[model samples]
Target chain A: MLFALRVAFRYLTANRVQSGLLIGGVALSVIVFVFMTALIRGLALFLTVQTTGQIAHVEMEPPRRIAEVMGPDARFAAQPISTFQRQQIRNWQLMVDQAEQLDHVVAVVPEVNGNGFLVRGTAVAPIALQGIDPSQIDAIIPLSKSIIDGSADLSTGGLLIGAELAEDLGLRAGVPVILRSDRGIERLIPVTGIFRIGLSNVDRRVAYLSIAVARPLLALPNGVTSVSIKLDDPALAPLIAEQLKRQLPLKVTAWQEKNRNLETALESQGRTGNFIQAFALIAIMISIASALLLTSVRRRGEIGIMRSFGISRGFVASVFVFQGVIIGLAGSLIGSALGYRLCLFLSEGITGPDGGPLLPIAPAEGGYVLVIVLTVVGSAISAILPAQAAARLDPVEAIQQ
Target chain B: MTLLKAEGITKSFRTGDIDTLVLKGVNLVLEPGEMVALSGPSGSGKSTLLNILGLLMQPSDGALSFMDKPMSGLTDKQLSAIRNTHYGFVFQFHHLLPDFTAMENVAFPAAAPAGGISAEIRDRAKMLLGRVDLTDRIDFAAMRLSGGQKQRVAIARALMNKPELVLADEPTGSLDRENSARVMALLREINHEDRTSFLISTHDPEIAKCCDRQINVVDGRIA
Candidate 1:
């Protein structure tokens, strides 16, 4: 083995130009593979963070109540219940405590959400009212960071409205507006803040208020309408929701269920990246195979001489294989390091309009180890045909040639 | 025991649809330390016979043996081992591995089989190179040597394994008179010093006259 390795290295170094070109070709393929992988994964992560950062990872709510026939012989028809009282979670504090104790659950916020109209001197606009504890104002959405005017202070019976809603109602900070609840109850609340969160729905139709003031207006004094959960990793939302459903009797929903389009886009992007990466690997294999085959042909006379003097066919084949391994190993290492540096440069050296990374490429996610292993193994495999060809060469025919 | 024995040896080649017989039935014997020459015309099967005796080609029919052991049913791998351990070959062209140094080429036959060039293998290679009068050129690349030096290196490489039989198929064919005589003298000296058997095939009568005895082939059979 040492003898064969030495011969292989000598052959490669003897034709330095050819070996350099072959390794460079393999390296370029590896770079493409790494870059595509990093870009696709980074884009997926960026989109996910952008979407999930403004919404709760999971939402736990009261189960829907449908009236069913009680008699044994009666037909089992599901009927909708039209009740005067709104459905609410009466023991929300218990669920909140349970959620907060679970792994990956960062925050468990109990809130009363309802629809209402904000009127300022007859300029009325509809709003989705979210009532939460003042201390948990930025638990899910980071409202404090998004606040464009005034402060995200919902204490002292003040209301926080979105920029669009405030504009529509012609209201500002310290201005009194009459908010009429969907249940016909109304209150004159002072607008304390206005925020713009980039989401059209949230910025135009959502309003925030303290839970202490919202309980009476919405007529849910002792219960919360829903419990919203924030998890450290949004990808685990569905798993956590499943666990929660198994443990609790409430309706648990993950954000993925609510945003199917984003999931589809990410899956499609991943598949495209796989195709690109596969092509890169195939390109690497083809290049290595052809170059090694050429080398074998060029060294036919020398191989014949070796064989004539009793060198085994196995030795000849192993020499070619070692050449492939060396080229693959060198190429992958160089390409991986170069790809990582390129990604880092693109991510850190360039900025987007919003001062974020321009390309959303994650240098850390380039799959370095995986690419290196694949390229080296693929290169070795690719050399097998040429190795066999060289090994099978008849000494008489080769010498005659 | 005879170093090599051939009985009714026959060889044929298939050219598309027809077979051409290259070697006909012939009987021959080689002793342990005899230097025999195979002399023949261009169309004669002298090279084919040499190739068959060296285990580089298989006889189409009949039996061959080395030291009374039959070569009939052995695998290619077994045949290769026998050739490596018991026989060496010097070709018409000095087919030295061009990228390797003279020392490396000399060490190859033994090194490849033993997995590497140990200190003993290296010393033996150096001794062989020195015996071939290429002591100063041992570190030079094979391609950098002159015709005579490369042939000498080839001779040293053939003796690297200390084989009992060294087959030379026109070993000095491509060299000038001076280099050819030098290479042949080196071969004769090694044959005398180590008592290594020689089966050299050549078309030159002068080269044949230098051997202990000469076998002449006219057609496919020995004349």
Candidate 2:
């Protein structure tokens, strides 16, 4: 094998320019593949954020029950958990504290959600009210960054209504509005700010206030409805949710479970990515094979003499095989390094002012390793046909040629 | 003892519907130590007989044996093994690999069978280079050597494995008079010193004059 390798190395280096070109070609193909995957994954991740961004990645709510408690018989209760009514989770602050302690869970905030109506003058419409602590909400959502009108000023006292909801009621910052609950209880509060999250449902019917103000108004003695969670890695939401489900007496839902459209879109995009990668590998294989086939033909006379000198057909074939391996190994390694740097350079150029990458291009270590392995294997596979042709050459005919 | 033998050997090449016979009912034999020359006109099948005898081409009819082992019963691996271990070949073109140094080319036959270049094999290659009077050019790439120097390296390569009989097909055909005489003399000295038999095919009368016996090929049959 070493003898063959030595011969192969000399043959390759003798051509110097072609050998360099082959290595460069393989590297370019690998770069295209690796960079493509990074950009696609990053885009998928960004879309995940857009879909699950305004809402929580995982939401923990009290289990649905017909009755708040079991009868004297103490059988388990089954009931639809309404968004309204006495559905608050008991001891939710403790649950939030514990859930935030879970692996990969970045933030957890107790939330109060209820169905109500907003009324101003002759205009009245239904609304979903959200009550949350300002300090905790900041970690769970980019509330301050999302505000477009007025200030994220639930700090003092007042409400933050959605842009469309405020517009529908002829409301603006500092305007007093009447709020009516599902139970016919009414109260008046002034709007302190407005936010637009690019979603019509949230913009039209949602209103936000500090939990300190809305908790008592909802007639809750203690506890909040559910805990909203944000994870350091949104992809880990499902894993953390599974653990939280086992640890807590509540229903835990990951953003992936709540947003099936995004998951399906990413899945289809992933298939498309795999198709492109397969094509890239095939292209690399064909390029290497085509190049080495010419080399084999040019060396036909040399091969004949070697065979006549008593070198086996196996040895003849392995000479070319060894060439393929060298090309594959050298090309993939150089390409991986080049691709990693290219990804980093490209990601920086295509981002928004918010400092987060606009495309969400992730070039993970596992992804790089997979591409390198495939490139090496694919290159070696490309050598088989040419090597076999060289092996089957008749010594007499080849010498004559 | 007969080191190599052939009986009623025939070879024909076909293209489309026509079959052109290159050799017909040819017989050849090589003893333990002898210098023999095959002389013939162009297309008289002198090179064809050499190729058949050298195991590079299989004869169309009749059997060939090396060290008394018939070729018809041997597998491809066995044939390759016999070719590698017992037969050495020198070609009209020298056929030294252009990318390899003279020393590397000398060690090729021995290095080729085994994967590595062993110390003994390298030393033997150096000794062979010394025998060809190409010791000074041993480290030069075959492409960088003069025509005569390259042929000397080729001669060294053919003797690398110390085969019992060496087949030379017009080994001096491409060289000038001076270089041709030098190459022929080297072959003769090696044959006499190592007791290695030689079956050389050539058109030069001067080359045939130095051989122990001269065999003539007339129209594909020895005359």
Candidate 3:
């Protein structure tokens, strides 16, 4: 093998220009592979972070309760289900503890969720009220960072409303507004803060309050309505949601289930990335194979002489194979380094109007080891045809020619 | 025991729908430590017979043996191994690997099989190069050498494995008269010193006379 490698190296070095050009071609293809991989992965990551940042990775709510019909007689079986009864998680703290014990669970915040109307001076607007611990105001939706008025202090019966809701109801910091819950309960709460999260649903229709103030107002004096879970990796939401469902009797929902369009877009992007990567590999392989085949043909007489001296066909074939390996190894190494540098350069220099990287190219996610291995293995496989051609050359016929 | 033997060897090539017999049924024997020449005109089958005897080509029908071991039953790999270990070849064009140095070319047959050019292989190549009077040119690239020097390197390469028989197919045919004489002298000196056999295939009568004896081929038959 060493002898074949030596021969292969010598053959490549003998024609420096040709070998250089071939290696450069392969390197260019590898650059394409690495760039596309990093870009797609980076885009997916950015989208996931942007979406999951404003929502709970997993949510648990009380299951529906249907009253069963009980009959003392054989033919009497009519039951009426009440519609005014509130559905609330009675033991939400226990469910929160169980969810917190699960792997990847970073934060679990129990909430008193309800629908109400924010009214101020005859300007009434519907709002989704989310009641949580004021200390963990940023546990799920990062409401603290998005606060544009007053403070996130929801203690002393204060409410945190969205900017659009405040605008609609003519409310602002340290102002009192009337909140009427669906349970027919009413309270005059002072607005503690106004937050704008850039999402229409959150900025226009949602309000935050302290869980203590919300329990009495929503008619849930001791139990919360739901539990919102945050995780270290949002992608693990579905798996954690399944485990949570099995561990508790609550209805568990992963964020992905609620945002099917995002998942679909990400999947389609990944498939497109795979196609581009495949084409890059194919181009590299075809270039190497065709170039090495030409080399085989050019050195026919030398190969014939080697065979005449009783060199094994395997040895001859391995020379070409080793050449492919050398070229692939060199090109991929150069390309990976360049690709990473290019990503870093682009990320640092290219910015959008918001001062963030325009493309969100993650240099660290370029799949360096994977691309190198694939290029090298693919190059070796591509060389097989030319290697076989060189190995099968008739020494007598070749020498005579 | 005979070093090599061939009985009723025949070879034919087919073009389109026609088959042309290149070698008729022929018999020959080569003893150890003997130099012989195969002299024939163009299309006289000398090169074909040499290729068959050297194990580079298989005869259509033949019974061949080396050191009394039957050759017909062996696989291609086995035949290649036998050739690498027991036979050597010097071609008309020198056929040196142009990218390699003289020493590398000399050590190729042995080094390639052993996986690398070891210290021992290197020393043997140097010694062979010295024997061919190319010691000063051992490190020179094959292409950089003169025709005579290249042919000398070729002769040294053939002796790299210390084979019992060296097949020279018009080995000095492409060289000038002076270089040809020098190459022939080197071959003769090696044969005499190592007790190695030589089978020189040539069209030059003068070159044939330099060998111990000559076997002429006419119309694919030994004459």
Candidate 4:
């Protein structure tokens, strides 16, 4: 095997131009595969991280279709959780206490969600209202840094509106606004804070209020719609959810499962990665096949002589296979390194259609290396036909010409 | 005792509707340390007979034995092993790999069984090249050598494994008289020194006269 490798190396070195071209072909394919896969994955990752960072990990609500919650025009719905169902569901305090006892649970917050018409002296506009605990809101959702104006504090009978919503309403800090719930009852609240998340859906029509004020305005008797929990490690949420299901009577879901659409998008990105990688491998195989075929034809007489020297057909075949593997590996390594750098350069420049910067694309380095190794092996296997052809040549006929 | 023997050997090739018989009812035996020359006209099956005896081709209807072992129904791999270990061949053309140096070309057969060329095999190839008086040209590419020098390298390659039987098919056919004589002298010296048996096929009577024994082939049959 060592002797065969030496010969193969010498052959390749002697034909540097051919070897370079073959390796370059393999490298180009690898680069294309890695770059395409990383781009799609990076986009998905950015969107997911933005969405999850803003929303609570787990959202508990009455079993309602997404269409209903999002409203007829796919806008925020005006209705709050019914008073009776809210009473029957476990209280925010009780659920929090129960969740804290679980191994990985860190914190929990109960929230009430509804839509209200904000009127500042005949300047009326609808806004999606979230009622949250002043102390626990930050734990469930990262709201402090998300504040566009005023504060995220819910104790001051104040309200926080999205930046766009606030702009449209012509309201600012220390301004009083009348909020009329779906029941037509109204209460005067001060605009203490505002936020702009740069997402059209959130910034155009969203507001936040304290649970104390929102409960009375929505005609609910100290009732909250959902209990959201935070965990020490988000990945362990599924196991914690199973435990929660066993302990709590209500339905439980992990954050990952709750956002099934995003998860599906992530999974599709993974499939795209696999497909691109397979395409690259196929390209490498083609190059290997061509290289081996050419090598075999050029070395026909040598192959005949080797066979005449008692070298088995299998050994002769192995020599070519080894050559293929060496070429594939060399190409893949160089290509992958080039691809990684290319991905890094592309990540900085890529942006969403909405003008948001795309996330930096960085896949596990070890995983990339594994993929290239597999490609080299696959290429060697693909060279089998050519190798066998070279090996089975008749010594007399081969040397005749 | 016969070192190599073939009995009732027959070989045929089919081209379109015609089947041409290249060898018919040919019987021959080669003793250890003997040098036999086969002289024949073109298409007389001298090379075909050499190929069969060298184990590069199988006789259509015959039995062959090497070192008293029968050679019927043997696998291609088995034939190749016997060829590698027991027989060496020098063709009419040098057939040295162009990419390899003369020494490397000579080392090829010895390198084959080992699956690669080692430093020791390289040294042996160099030594063999030196024996053929090509020490200065050993490092030169086979393609760069003169026709006679290339043939001498081919002869050295043929003797790399110290095989008992060496088949030479018009080994000097491509050379000028001076180079041809030089190549023939090298083959003679190797044959005499190593006691290696040789069966040479050639059209040149001058080359044939140099061998210890001579056989004439006419129309694929010993005449």
Candidate 5:
């Protein structure tokens, strides 16, 4: 094995110009591979975590009535429930306890959520008025950390308003606001904090108050409108939700199920990334394979002499196989390092309006390992034919040539 | 003791339906430590016979043996073992791997069997290079050496494993007069000092005259 490796190294070094070119090609391809994997996966994770970070991984709630089915025979349709039916969970505390017992369940928080109009001097903008125990909300959404102004406290019958909503109403901390529910009830609530979650749609239309303060205004006494759950692994939300459906009477919804368009968009772009990576791999393979083929042809005499001196076919083939491995490992190392720098450069150079990075690249270590493993495997595979060709040379003919 | 013996050896090649016989019923023997020459004109199968003698080719009809072991019944691996441990070859072209140094080329045959170059092998190779007067250029790559120096390194390589018999097909065929004599002298010195037998094929009578015994082959028969 040492003999073969020495010979292989000598052959590669002897043709520095050619070997350098081949190695460069492989390195470039690997760079593209690692970069794309980091970008696509990083972007996907950023979007999902950013979106799901604000929402619950799984939500358990009373099922909303399905739209009334119109019968083919108009006379046979049953009377449907009115659009104004009350929405509330039946037995929330038992279900929340049971959910906390399920595997991987991190935290469970019950909340009352409904649309309300905030009236402040003729500006009546509609906002989602959500209720939660501020301390418990930390386990689900980290709403406490998300508070950019004043405090996360809602204990004094004060509310947390969105940055955009606050700007719209000319409201701030320590200011009083009138919240009018759709049920014709009104209450004046103090603004305790302002939160900027970085999502414009949510920032423009969401407000938060304590459950004690919100439940009575919304006409719900003890039951919550829904229970939101945080899980150890958000990706496992769907499977857990599926399992929850069988055990609980309420509707169990996964984050992915609620965001189907985001899921499809994420998957389609991931496929595109994979497609690009595959072609880059093929290009790398072609470059290495052709370079080796030329090397085999040029080294025919050396192979013949080695064979005539009793070198086994397998040993000769192994020389080229070793070449593939060295090239793969070297290229992947260089490429991965460069890819990391590229992502870092892009992240720092690009910024959002609010001074945060436009593209926050969270590179997964596993992705880099995958690139190295796959590139090496692909490189070795590409060397097979050339290795075989080198091994199977006719000693007589080769020496003559 | 007879180091090698062949009886009624014949070789042929087919061109379409026409069978052209190169060697027909050729007989040969090499005694231990004796240098013998196979002389023939062009197209008279001298190199072909040399190839068969080196076990690089199979005779169409012949029984050949080295040290009383039948060569016909051995596996490819066994044949390779016989080639590496018992027989050595010096081609007309030298055929040194251009990528390696003279020392590396000399260490090749020993390295081939062991799959690595041992310290002892390197020492022996350096010693052989010294014997060939190539000590000064031992670390030079094969392509950097002159034609005769390359051939001398090839000779050192053939003897790396201390084989009993060395086969040379015009070892100096590509050299000038001075370098050719140098290469031939190196081969003779190794043959005399180590008692290694040699069977060389060439068209040069001057080279054949240096051999202890000469067999003249004409039309694939001993003349």
Candidate 6:
């Protein structure tokens, strides 16, 4: 086996142009695969960071219902939490408190969420209004750092508005703004701050108010739609979720499950990445196949001589396969290095619409290494057909040439 | 006892709609250490007969025995094993592996075993290269050698397995007159010194004249 490998090594080295072309082709494929996967993963990470930075590690809401209540002209009826529903909501909060007592949990906060319209001197836009505790908001969301214009104080009926939302409303810091809930409940509150997070969903359509003011505006007392929790370590989130499920009185969900749309989008991105990787692998395989076929044809006379001297067909096949594996490994190493550098360049240059860094790309991760290795192995396997054909050649016919 | 025997050997090939008979009812015997020459014009099936005798091809109908063992019903793998252990072949083109050195090419057959090239095999290869008067050129690549030296390396490779039978198919056909004479003389010398039997196919009458026995093949029949 060692002798066969030696001969194969010499054979490939002697054909410098052919070997170089094959290696280059394989390396190009591997680099493309690694780069595309990294891009998709980076996009997913960007979105996750944006969403998680606003909300806590987990959020709970009422289960979805598929019903439309038509009024005078097909207007949907409002689905408000009842007195009994408020008790159920309190029970859920009790569960969140229990979860905070777990070993990994750091804190938990409850918030009421509802859709409302904000108006500043006749300029009006819809917004997702979240009612949070002034003292506990920092523990759960760390929103104080994101404040741009003013503080995140929720006292004395003061509200926080996104930068874009504030601009659209024509409201300055400490200016009074009127907000109306869907149930026609109206309140006049002063804008405490204007903040920008560079996310369209957050900056354009979000407003923050105190939980005490939101309770009467949404026509619910001591009621909240969800309880969000913060963990001491992000990696222990799944374990904490399981512990909460066992301890909490009401149903509990992890952030990944509560936001199924984001999770599904991330999963689809991964699947698309896998498809791109497969395509790159196929390209490498085709290159290896063509290279091995040409090598086998060129070495026909040598193969015949070996056969006549008692070398088995299997041994002959292994020599070409070994050559392919060596080429693939070398190409993958080169491609991975190139891909990592390309990722760094892209991350540094590409920017978000707000002129912030677009994708947060780290160095080559374990996942990138795994993808390159798989591509090399796949290319080696694809060379088998050509090797078998070379091995099965007739010695007499081969030598006749 | 005769070292090799063939009775009623027949072979055919099919190309498209035509079946071509290359050998028919050929009977021959080779005693141990005997040197025989097969001579014929082109299209006379001398090469086909040599191929069948060398176990590189199978006769459509024949009864063959080597060292008292029947060869008629052997599988390809079994036949290959027997050929590797007991026979060596030399082709007209030399067919040396271009990537290998003369010494490495000569030791190729012995390197086929699972444990890889042993010290004894390397020593034997060096000794064979020395016998062919190519000790100095043993480290040279096969492509770098002269035509005569390349053929001599081919001869050394054939003797690597220490086979009982050495089959040559127009071994000197591609060489100049000087190299052709040298290769033929070397084959004759090896036969005389090692007592190894030889069956060679050649179109050159001069080469046939040097063999101990000559068999003429005409139109797929031994005449």
Query: What does DockQ give for each predicted structure?
Result: 0.83, 0.79, 0.80, 0.63, 0.60, 0.67
CA deviation > 4 Å runs, candidate 3: A68-84, A93-104, A120-123, A166-176, A188-190, A236-249
Model 6 agreement with the true structure over A56-167: per-residue lDDT tens digits = 6755544444443333443454553323232226455666666667786777778877889998776889999888787885776666887889888888678888888888
Reproduced native contacts, each prediction: 0.77, 0.82, 0.75, 0.74, 0.65, 0.70
Q: Give the alpha carbon lDDT tens digit for every residue of A205-235 in model 2.
A: 8888888877766766588888889887788
Interface RMSD of each: 0.7, 0.9, 0.6, 1.9, 1.3, 1.4
C-alpha lDDT of all candidate models, in order: 0.92, 0.85, 0.91, 0.80, 0.86, 0.81
Runs off by more than 4 Å, candidate 4: A60-84, A88-91, A97-107, A114-116, A120-128, A182-185, A218-223, A231-236, A348-360, A363-367, B118-123, B137-141
- C-alpha lDDT of residue B169 in model 1: 91
- Per-residue CA lDDT of model 4 for B75-125, tens digit only, reads 987887888778888888887778788988898788867767789999899
| Worst window of 10 by summed lDDT in candidate 5 chain A | A76-85
Write the residue-wise lDDT of candidate 5 on A99-192 in tens digits: 9889989889999988889999999989888899867857666677878888988887898888999999999888999999877789988889
Question: Local error of candidate 4 at A328, Å?
Answer: 0.8
Residue pairs with backbone overlap in model 2 = A42-A360, A42-A361
Backbone clashes for every candidate come to 0, 2, 0, 1, 0, 0
Residues B1-223, candidate 3: write the lDDT tens digits: 8999999999999999999999999799999999999999989999999999999999999899998889997887898899899999999999999999999999999999999999999999999999888889989999999988988898889888999999999998999999988888888888898999999999999899889999999999999
**Tens digits of per-residue lDDT for model 1, A68-181:** 335444455464434434689999989999888899999999999999998877578888989999999999999999888888988878998888877887778888899999
Give TM-score, chain B, model 6.
0.97
Q: Cα lDDT for residue A301, model 6?
A: 80
Query: A321 in model 2: Cα distance from truth in Å?
Result: 1.3
Chain A: TM-score in each candidate?
0.92, 0.88, 0.91, 0.84, 0.83, 0.81
Residue A54, model 4: Cα distance from true site in angstroms: 1.7
DockQ, prediction 6: 0.67
The order of the candidates by TM-score, greatest first, is 1, 3, 2, 4, 6, 5
Residue lDDT tens for model 5, B1-223: 6789999999998999999999999888888999999998988899889888888888999889889777897776777778888888898898998878999899988886687878898899999999988999988989999888889899999998899999999888898999888888888898899999999999999999889989989999888
Off by over 4 Å in 6: A60-84, A87-97, A103-106, A112-129, A140-142, A155-157, A177-189, A198-206, A210-225, A232-239, A349-366
- Residue B123, candidate 2: C-alpha displacement in angstroms: 2.2
Better model by lDDT: candidate 4 vs candidate 5: 5
Tens-digit per-residue lDDT, B1-223, candidate 6: 7889989999999999999998989999998999899999999999888888888888999888898788888876888888888898888888898878998888888877643668898899999999999999988999999988999999999998889999998999999998898888999999999999999999899999999999999998889
Candidate number with greatest TM-score: 1
